[model samples]
Target chain A: TYTASALAFALRNLPVPVILVGSQRSSDRPSSDSVLNMKTSLAIFKEAPFGEVVVCMHGTISDDYVLAHRGVKVRKMHSSRRDAFQSINDAPLARVDFPGMRFKMLNPRFIARGRREDFQVVSKFSDRVVLLKFYPGMECGIIDFLVDRGYRAIVFEGTGLGHIRNACVDSVARATEEGVLTIVTTQTIFGRVNMNVYSTGRRLLKAGAIPGHDILSEVAYVKLSWMLGSYPGLDRKDYVELFHRNIAYEYNPIHKDSLFPVWSHEY
Target chain B: TYTASALAFALRNLPVPVILVGSQRSSDRPSSDSVLNMKTSLAIFKEAPFGEVVVCMHGTISDDYVLAHRGVKVRKMHSSRRDAFQSINDAPLARVDFPGMRFKMLNPRFIARGRREDFQVVSKFSDRVVLLKFYPGMECGIIDFLVDRGYRAIVFEGTGLGHIRNACVDSVARATEEGVLTIVTTQTIFGRVNMNVYSTGRRLLKAGAIPGHDILSEVAYVKLSWMLGSYPGLDRKDYVELFHRNIAYEYNPIHKDSLFPVWSHEY
Candidate 1:
């Protein structure tokens, strides 16, 4: 969901407009070395020197030229070929040929709008946290182990968006109240957590969770670490509030774009 | 990273125009409850339903009664009751319960929009697939066990976005390309595959594998079951392509909303 988003964000926000490209073909294939994929991507990147996002994928032939895809517009075909990538609901920002003519590339990467110094790693992650994924008949003692081991936070990958066995809530609550900040992320990759929508999630929230907001679990762990690390000297009250703040785009309360591109692990 | 986005998206897209007026305080708190929060949210969701998305967190008894938070705007305030949740690079969408009363409440959450469907459960998991997550210094026999079990698919939760130690790659390739449908996902939850980003990711992708595309492990398990079960008769060509399809928003090629919302879990 996010591999491309992070790459897109990096490119669009970068000082230069580097075109993003990926090949569906296994590089190992006899003829599938992504030779054309790389050539086309390089063409798109060199298209314009200014800031922009572009994804180039195989177009028509096994050698069918290529298409320049928009970062946000791109989707996966999963075919194991350069064509595995496709444009989503939106249209491809533009299209171009392979490295045959690098000079013809229109959009060049350029980060001219912002200060260079501000090019900081906007993605902050809470490294100390671990996801104690709850499974059927999961041992409650796991929570004890996490807490005893000094885990700063535990984002439960609950059954739904957020729900754990009733038996586990108090233990979680105890952990949270003990200053081992506990939160819940969904085992489901999609969908939102409406604790009130169900008896289960509601109970967990009431006990003491700072909802994960829609941050992916991996993102949550890293963000939590960043937050915890930031508030090293604060007390419980402060710690709880600190977690709520959008320290790094952690909890984007309003912007949808902030959530999209759900930038995550590198592919 | 997502709880905020969950709310952010709820406000942005869900046609109900549900203004999320929530309280940090629950109904049981001394003079606490979401009463005022609910009232305010209802009014907003009811009135001026378009043009923007807003979030009213208690702005200030500490000037923190409920600041109308924007989707993308978030800042990490170092010290304040509402300090944690701040506007980044921008101001609040509109403050609620503070010095003003704008966008009155409307029907409590009306309805969510754009629900994606048209997918089936991957029930064949019983026949084969397995998720092999890596830990430091893992043994070689682990792969042997899955292969021995005659598993049809083996998904590795790589260190980052689908990366494993060098030692495991050869075995993984030999086992999967040999017909195991081996795939890779990141241990980190948010990102998707970028086989080209690193040599490791590239190598794995080349070894006859598919990238998990940020699909969470929970979904990965079910989806794999569904895919393998449904397409048991197909060739690797068709089988691998199935992984990249956007069957039910499990992995949206692109999401328009900025923040996913506080409710990222999808139970």
Candidate 2:
């Protein structure tokens, strides 16, 4: 899902359906999902009207349908389940019934099929960016390592509404001082990251860490790479403004609550 | 929630319930959840059984009930919701009804009330451990920084099914060689991380990352600190074995499919 989303960001303004598909089980296995996933993806390619980057995979354990998830909003959830890839923080874009051979749109917001000539590819990506997941006893030296190495950006997968330990705030301040772009995304995986509610998060924001609103950490890394690679000369303010803007449907304005299609609603 | 869980692990074998409570809104606000949360927590303290470390918080948007979550299993999911703290990968230990003044044990697998004399405190903690989240372009130098600085452990919040980039495997190997314990937990936040399924994960395991089976990354860091501090002279094999064992019910043997209490049952 991260690779697909990164490709989507790199290949901007797609004019045709860019469906990324993969099978959880091997072809040698009797219960392999390869054939069904391939067939469903073919069906989507032939019939779907959207031209956005999307992932098509088994929608349920029973293999009755395939869900077309927006590349930026999808995640591989379960380890070895056939239906491992699921849309996160948002509903899937479409669904294709296997037995009925029918296609249906689940979420109407999508990039419609566009002209073939309008396609543009900004494929360059920066490898200097790093992602750090902050825990209680995380050392401040890791941030210093990246800053000293002249890295372009650092994305923090912070805990609970986007917070790093208070001890590391000065390190982040130093990173920003070195002109490194620091962004904070949540590790909760289901909720939007708001760096304004608590003193810890507020201190992080004050230290020049950009709050990654509703953006998945993986997608944020991909987007940051694209921004750094595509526009190398932009000022810090311009880069942050660009990073916060909704590009390729990465930011969801409203946070909708949805289950993983199997959990019971009992909290 | 992380602090509560760390305390729960450090203070072993509770004989009486230890209830931790907090409010989302300030007391000055009319919509503050403080009073209700406090009253419900007192109710649990005065009447409830099951001697364990638990977090008491509002169960839903309404002020009807408060949930008692196992301290080690809970996480602060939302930024400011009254019911922000939730039990991840497990059910709440019990629920306290506000209107009826009734207490119900939602999950009976709790540490029952024991003799008060059996309680023990092992609160020593080391701050040398770090939690690094792996992304596509993460620099390997960060691991080297920790290992060179004589850090004791590295808990990696890896991608789906517990994987770091292929390039960083050698760095992890070096960390393990230096007697720096390396552990891998999932960023998925909902599923058990399996290093046996994918080649990247297999390589990470071979590089000496102990698979953090069904343990939240935050809890993993806390447990590692406790191990390092409480039992100082243990060798690498002893530490790995101790880390894998379920201490203070941190590891959930079964992954329950429970929603966040409010989401609709739709994928």
Q: Return the top candidate by DockQ.
A: 2
Local distance difference test values of all predictions, in order: 0.52, 0.81
C-alpha-based local distance difference test score of model 1: 0.52
**Model 2 docking tier (incorrect/acceptable/medium/high):** acceptable
Please write out the lDDT profile of model 2 over residues A6-48, one tens digit for every residue: 7888776667789888888888899988888888888889888
Candidate 1 chain A minimal-lDDT segment of 10 residues: A258-267
Q: Pick the candidate with the highest lDDT.
A: 2
- TM-score for the A-chain in each candidate structure: 0.60, 0.96
Best-fitting candidate, scored by TM-score: 2
- Model 2 has fnat of 0.41
Q: Comparing chain B with the reference, what is the TM-score for each candidate? A: 0.52, 0.95
Q: What is the TM-score of each candidate against the true structure?
A: 0.42, 0.93
Candidate 1 CAPRI classification by DockQ: incorrect
